[model samples]
Target: MAVEVKYVVVRNGEEKMTFATKKEADAYDKMLDLADSLGEWLQQAPLNLDDEQREGLSFFLAEHKDALGQILRGAAPAEAPKKAAKVKMEKSVATSKEGSTSEKQAA
Candidate 1:
């Protein structure tokens, strides 16, 4: 029912990465993309790195995400966003709270 990938960070030997399913893979990929963009954006405006260097860094990260993480990072490959079990519990709690609030307001 779920696809999972276990990855170890090369630089930080102790860091472990795991994704529950294809959706999780996709969410991670998007996260990587945003991080990459933010790095570039920072360099261009406030950071002011040269354009050539910026392009090179983007290319490098795009090419190397798999080595950085557990699997080859690409587009959102999963149909749904993979969420941690803890997040699911949090969502349930929030929903219950909202329901209770609604009942109180109705009363």
Candidate 2:
């Protein structure tokens, strides 16, 4: 049997895309990571953002709210005055762990 190599993009418990080479896959992954970073940074500190940039960022957050939430939620510290926010953060972490487990299983 011949061995085949494929780079896969998995999202929300599903394989969304496949790449023929690892470099291509890495590029796509880096782009996604950059997008997440941009979203988080914009949310945290959006000083002096132009109208078009603000609109694009808003659209990106709206389109990828779930994924962006997971990224930001994980990075955020557990220090909030409201108990509900703290509890929500904990729940998000739990769900994130579960997702990591699923990814490990898939790998």
- The lDDT leader among the candidates is 2
lDDT of 1 by residue, 10-39 (tens): 223543245656676566566556556856
- How far is 57's C-alpha from truth in model 1 (Å)? 16
TM-score of each: 0.30, 0.36
Q: In candidate 2, what are the lDDT values of residues 35-66, reduced to their tens digit?
A: 65665678667388875786578657655655
* Candidate 2: residue 10 lDDT (0-100): 73
Clashes of each: 0, 0
Q: Candidate 2, residue 85: CA error in Å?
A: 53
Model 2 lDDT, full chain set: 0.71
Task: List the global CA lDDT of all models.
Answer: 0.60, 0.71
Backbone clashes (count) for model 2? 0
How much is 74 displaced in model 2, in angstroms? 35
Off by over 4 Å in 1: 1-16, 47-107
